[model samples]
Target: MLERSTKIESPGVLKAGNPNKSLASWQGRKTEIAQIQQWLTDKNTFLIGIEGIGGTGKSMLATKIYDEIADFPKRFWADVSNGAGFSDLARQVLSEFGFPVPEQETQLVEALVGCLRSGQFLLIIDNLESLLQPDRQWGSLFYGDFFQAWVEDGGNSKVIVTTRERPELKGFEWLTLKGLQVDEGVALLTVLGIRGDLTQFVELVDGHPLLLRLVADLLKEEYSQDPDLSRLADLGLGNLRQLLTDSQVVGIHHRKNVGMVLVLDASFNRLNELQKALLLNISVYRGAVDSAAAVAMLPGSSAPEIEEELRNLVKRSLLVDKLNGKRRFDFQPLILAYVRYQAGDQSEAHQKAIDYYRSIAKQPPWKTKDDVKEYLEIFDHFYQLQDYNSAFDSIRICNDFLTLRGYYVDKVELYGQLVSKWEEIGARENRNYQAALIFLGNAYDSLGQYQRAIEFYQQSLEISREIGDRNGEGKSLNNLGNAYNSLGQYQRAIEFFQQSLEISREIGDRNGEGASLGNLGNAYNSLGQYQRAIEFHQQSLEIKRDIGDRNGEGASLGNLGNAYNSLGQYQRAIEFLQQSLEIFKEIGDRNGEGASLISLGNAYNSLGQYQRAIEFLQQSLEISKEIGDRNGEGASLGNLGNAYNSLGQYQRAIEF
Candidate 1:
């Protein structure tokens, strides 16, 4: 038998109406109630563990148990949110249950147990995980003898503990509570004037009380109309997630304290400018990007400093990711949206990309002149994408290379067109129609503007041939092949590819050889010659591999996979895509990886593996959105819709 303490009623604090109070007029959680009541009534069980997700009304559940069990001599409530030691745990429980506080760890549990044995008390321990916290020396505070002693000997009254984690306590009856069912969630929502059908929604989230309440809050705030259940059922929580920003009221009691939402704001205020930028920069990754990739995205930081900050985020639970693995770290979606809103004001990402492009532009041209054409090529890509700010900035920086030193015909043409867009000019240079004609031709060919493409390629090819530049002539032929292929003129495309291949092989340019081979593969693909297309692509892949051109090899592999897919060889297609995906990730080619994911998802969709298809497509959509690839994102979204539709989840199929 255990000792006992003086009789006392469970403390009934009348501070429920206080503005900052966490107390609620609780109602549901019947299962949890029954489980704990049984645990308390059982004589064999010494420890009772109550577990639930955040905001699942865990505190209220614990509070109710404290209030209801009246016959115990004393009742104590210990908040273990900070993780307590055995000594601290005994002291807090004793204090809350109206037992005298013991002065030292050696006598703390004995004093409490003696009081209990004397027929005085029961203890309801709050935040059970908090008792796991250690002192500054980094040692466990409550793992051994005392914990066993409390349960085995402190007999007369029972002890109950609540935690978010599944604490492995011996002789403890663990009761895990997830979120409410569909009906319960809806009731909770309806009570707050929130609206949603939620009938067809796949409940991936464990009905965690906080998240349910958040969804309910979002429904009330954003989608208040359209009574047809079909419309409501069609939408998923993802839509709600998008609409639910930081300021909006979240889950169950939408009016309750939004303390957790403010955690990021406090975290932001605590960090310096550099740390803020570093954190925000890393947040833009496709998935849990490894530390090395994060460093690559941000150029200036040292490894040790970044590692320290990353460790800080992990400890604070701001950035959740496995410390090891390839796709290891991700900022929580809710947190990421907030960070994106904040980062737009501060990051120098655009400026950095521009600077890097300029540095690459400064590299010595192999056969071409110092025309700064490489920079123009990159600059215009950004320009056409409406990344105008970076384009304009780069155009300003490399105005020199675009002018006097530029002589390569393609570059000269690009320079003329590029300078024509600028409003400012000190010494206006004459436009060389010939060079503009050449560059514009090549650009049109690259863009699949075949008529425009053909016109430019013809013009450039004639000039290069006249100038005795066989290499330029060969490049023009390659563009001619690409343009013809786009126009469904496979015969013409093959002719051009053949000529280009001959010239490339004659010149011993391995890169040019791979390009010509890839071009021929494209021609074959266009003509529906699946086997021939794959063979050409494999030839291109070999050349790319030998030349150490990872980009070219991945492209060839992707093309080969597309061929296999078209032929209904799903397994082979998947294999090729997986290979391409590996290379893309290894080389940090997010855009390539996104495309591969889409292709793989499409293959899976064809095989009727809808869940896996949607999974991969969803990942693809996220990656594309992160990399600013709207086209890829849209394609993935459409595929995801199809997947849901095929699964008979019609309501979740489409979103306008």
Candidate 2:
């Protein structure tokens, strides 16, 4: 029984790395390979890096070179993207070279480098960009140092790395790989068993290897069912270009590659109903997905059946499968873009995805990274369904988690989409539309983009006034006041706060009234009016306590603490801030807790208690980092600097 289960499971695990066995037949890049071969044989060059965007065949070319180089005494290959780090690569090299592998990372790397320096070894590192920073620098210092040593001291041993970005290192011959020539593309299609002359098709795609292969596979599949080339003939270059233009896939647009979009559209069109449906449904996913998730997206489909379909899609070049600890499937960027564009009117599919993700998500107050990720999927589905209210609700539930956890940019993007959709539909006066504008404004405000925040706030205010929504009007006015205060325009902020206060009073919205009072306090505090700030904050605190708004009460307490600290009442400020911190902790408001800690740190620093101030600031920094609150993190660092400076530890202050 165990053996049977294992056999059944083994087929689903797609092995990764070193596609040498699978890529037996190859075409094109002969010129490029010869140049690389020359570089490899050159005693002066010890390293070569092939750089290109995805689907340009960087790995394929590297594998081809590896196969061609039989004269090398030793050859090794590692796919860096598939969980293979520098240490893993080192271990492979040491073990293969008959050297005893060291357990320590430094020792292992040293051993590998020593072995390479002593022999004629060739190492191929695939997807090297995975180990590189966005700025084209090595992500790991160990890898960088190892490579530098190889280039400087390795005798006769050569290393080739394939990446999307060229690493910032000297002593390496760089190859900026491009798509195949038209003739080469034609030959490749023929090798893939594509019938008919494909010179025009190849030219249309600009000889992009992956697009050609996809189109060829799709054509071959169609030909297998019916030996008719009429369909291929009918899709002339003109029609193909028109189809690509009409699709409007963002990836294709960015590449400005007419052939890519056309080929994807043709391939997508040739898929059977089930294949098309599966592709469209799975397009909702952002990244790698397992069989279970794929099965969930296709309701009423058996796991075995779905797995088989997934394999079929992989064979057709619609999906790419890999084993990164577990079997998963993904798409190339262009294909994902094309599929998303075609995924319209798939409400049932979107709902199925929503249900699947929701079923696996933890209940609210999402405690794990996975829970937050799942909610993002739910939000996406709701947005696709044009269910703006539910989508906004999803965002609201995870607002603090998103804001504090470095997902504020993502939150802003989601709100931008909502606003765009509402405007597209001309629903300017809709409550959700106004709410989305306010939410976007608040996001910008939190990010310190005060000008953008004011723009959104003004839009929301206009919409609220137009719709006679007094509560929304008050909220928008309060938000506008906050934005102005952030910009240091205290009087302008006060004017907005007064209007919001009047609206809140007229509508009997106790929460809005409290929020407006708090904004007034903040503006006054900014202007150095400590006594007036304290009075307003006290009023806000009373209203919040009456309404049982614990979060609001904490904010008011923190505001009063700041006002007292400004007034040089250090001990009194600490007392209020401590209370505020406790309330925030009890209510699980990490952002508020961070704010209170910073206030306490400032008060202690003012009192000449530098060490005590540092302790509080350090805690604030930790919380800020934990919650992804960049602004809070900056504030904590600046305050820590002040405290250290007060203690005459100028170096420590500078470091902070």
Measured by lDDT, the strongest candidate is 2
Off by over 4 Å in 2: 1-26, 30-179, 182-208, 211-277, 283-287, 333-344, 362-371, 585-588, 625-630, 650-655
Write model 2 residue lDDT over 1-656, tens digit each, in one string. 10010001000111123443246447878899889989987989988989776677887888788776777877887765522335446656787777765433445557878898888888888766655655666544367888888877867888888876677888889998887888888788777777655786666566778777776666666666642334665444346645544646455323435556656766777677888878888877655688888888776889888888888898888897876567788876547667777886678877888888888877655433345666776777787688987888876777777565434345566788789888898898777788789888877776667899999999998888887889888988998898899899999999999999999999899999999999999899899998999999999999999999999999999998889999999899989899999999999998899999999988988999889989999999999877667668878998999999999999999988
User: Tens digits of per-residue lDDT for model 1 on 1-656?
Assistant: 00011110111111111012133324467777888777667777767777754556666677776766556645656543322334445545565656675323345557767766666466666544433322212123333455577677867677776665554446778787656666666555456554345533314333445544444433332345632323333433234333333456555333222333433454566566766876777654333445665565566888677766676565444565453323245553345556766766433553444454455566532221224544553455454444544554544454433222222222323333443443133112212333444455544443345696687678667767776767776788988888888889899989999998998898888899899999999889889999999999999999999999998889899999999999999999999999999999999987789999999998998999989988889889988767545456667888888889888888889650
| TM-scores for the candidates | 0.37, 0.65
Model 1 alpha-carbon drift over 4 Å, by segment: 1-439, 442-448
lDDT of each: 0.59, 0.76
Among the numbered candidates, top TM-score falls to 2
| 220 Cα displacement, candidate 1 (Å) | 57
Point out the worst 10-residue segment of candidate 2 by lDDT: 2-11
